[model samples]
Target: MSPGIPDRRGLWVAVGAFVIWGLMPLYWHLLREVPSLQIVLHRAIWCAVLVASWLTLRHGRGWLREVLARPRLAAMLAASGVLIAANWGLYVWAVNAGHVVEASLGYFINPLLNVLIGVLFLRERLSAAQWISVALAACGVLWLTTRYGDFPWIALCLAGSFGLYGVIRKFAAIEAVRGLGVENMFVLGPALAWLAWIELGGDGGFFSLRWGGWTDLLLVMGGALTAIPLIFFAYAVRRVPLSVVGVLQYIGPTLQLLLGVLFFGEYFGPDRAIGFGFIWIGLAVFATDGVLAARRRVVAQQA
Candidate 1:
């Protein structure tokens, strides 16, 4: 495909990925009975299995060889693996513990955190509007903190881990699928160990007649749940503009927010609404600036 040409198929694929992510809370909600730690352990194992299988079939070990040969890349991926695993574990616990709204808030703040990382670590400059957006988001967080009488650590942790993960991957110079495959491999060992311990304790969920077969199957499907959207994301990014992807990324959090309020019947009082309103205003500025900037760049190129 030409670099600048838009493809409908790619757009659909990307949207599909974000939609799956948006609706993912419901899936985890179904497994609320399962321990969050165990759920994450299974997620790590099955994600590794699925990703590694796809990588092997697609390239017959070429990508793996390349990754292994690069010690720095492998080290970076190892760190990323740990971060992503923590992120997954935390998110699972948060969802199961009925912190879905806070979880969604984390993702909402993630893009802004990413911008902050870019400024701090990459020495990138931000526009005035961008600065305003960041300030608004900070105020929003403060609102939430004040209302809750404590720091929104769950939101902060999720944003921090994922934002840092994005930073590491930004410089890793690896393909998305392969990078994820390698990262998952690093976590797979611990995941297997955890599962073994659970099994030894006679609490393993796999093949348990007590837990319906459907539950067991859904647990297995966790691998696909983890991998498929990433695969779609990988496919989409190659074809779509970065700006488009950035906008589409919000779909996940939006869906999570709605699901929290409507489906899960989580709290969303006026104070919380005001806090979210501030954050939403910040996001509006951020997204508008991004879209306008992208358009200007495009127009300048054509000129």
Candidate 2:
């Protein structure tokens, strides 16, 4: 592969991952009858199983050994695991509780949050346009809060947790699949315990036959659904530029926003639109700055 040339296959893979993430609200909506906590537990447990199995098969325990050798990395993965689990649980609850629109808002805010995180924690400097973009996003959030007479905590929490998770992973310095596998392993104990308690207590949704085979299948497939896109993302990032990935990430939230409005039929009145419009403009500024920065880097490299 030439420098500055994207791998077409990787590009498609990245698109697939974002598309899956975007369409995930519909998947969770199917399990609306299941408790959000239970759904999250199932996701954690199954995702761990799938990721571990794949890692073991691919590297035959070498990856595990590599991760175990670095205690600091292991600890970082644990924190990231907790953050990701919280994100998953909250997102599921929000979707089933008819807050899909708000959930989408969280993801929409995530990239900007990532930028803020870079500035705050990583000591990375932001350009003037980047600062403007972040300010606009803040104003949008403020508009939504004051106009709607409620705080947008859901969006904030999601963005905060996921943004921190990304930062932690950035410092972890491990392969993405292996890092995720370790992260999930750290949470697997609690996840399994919760699942076991519910099943033993007869509160389990799986195999209850209440929602029938379809629900059971969906619950199990949750693991694959959780891990596969991440795998695709891992593959894509190695081959594609981070700027392209950043732009593509909006696909997921955009799809979620559409689903929340057109399919799930959540409220999207003029007020909401005005606030979102602000944030959208901010994202436009942010993304444009990123693309232009990437182009400058490429030009410098060519020179």
Candidate 3:
């Protein structure tokens, strides 16, 4: 509650959210039999139902109308919705296709990519240390690409789509929950229609039990899985410093990387390790600069 102290409850909440995100690969793995497209559709539909219900209860029907009144904001949310949906689809597909290591690489690259986005699109300037961090991350990607004889497109796409989504949301000027609710609403119709089409064609995994009752339950619970962490994140950011959040964000991908290598048994030879090492060093640099900058600002305020 003090100027510099973190709220203990918020820190825990932030940890919980990132942990859930980190463990998400396991959740999707449970639905491995279900097609990735179907999983994504179910996620979109159920998440929309839950989030819209919450918004309706909290702010009533007028909340949506209020957002729609701003055509520009609505359009931005629509664009963001498509990007997020694409991100979700790609992530789920990658996990099911035995690319979890590469997927984790995407999230690892995300924070640095966000910094690059700020510099390029927002015209923001970075410190020399920040520039070095970006360069290091770039070198990591290059190392993986050249050494492996394969481009890390899956990782790059995931980071790029999510990064652009963040940029759009930055200027959207809406509450996180409300913005997400609106975004879901934009995609809900198409998701529902796709699911319905599949079900009618008797190829759906939901009630048909093609993958059994547990699959059905997981599919439905996907909504809660999708929304709860985001809600927690929204709550946490309001209480904690951005620098703290920046550091905490890595917990998710770290767990994911572990799950990929340890649990999923994906390949991780020395070549890949060297590349990841470069990125990890870059992240360390970026995080240190962020903390020092935050401390400087606090000291200036106190002085």
Top candidate (TM-score): 3
Task: Report clash pairs, candidate 1.
Answer: none
Given candidate 3, what's the lDDT at residue 240? Answer: 91
Per-model lDDT: 0.91, 0.93, 0.96
Residue 69 lDDT in candidate 3: 95
Every model's TM-score = 0.97, 0.98, 0.99
Between candidates 1 and 3, name the one with more favorable lDDT. Answer: 3
Residue 177's lDDT within candidate 1 is 96
Candidate number achieving the greatest lDDT relative to the actual structure: 3
**Per-model tally of clashing residue pairs:** 0, 0, 0
Stretches > 4 Å off in candidate 2: none
What is the TM-score (0 to 1) of candidate 3?
A: 0.99
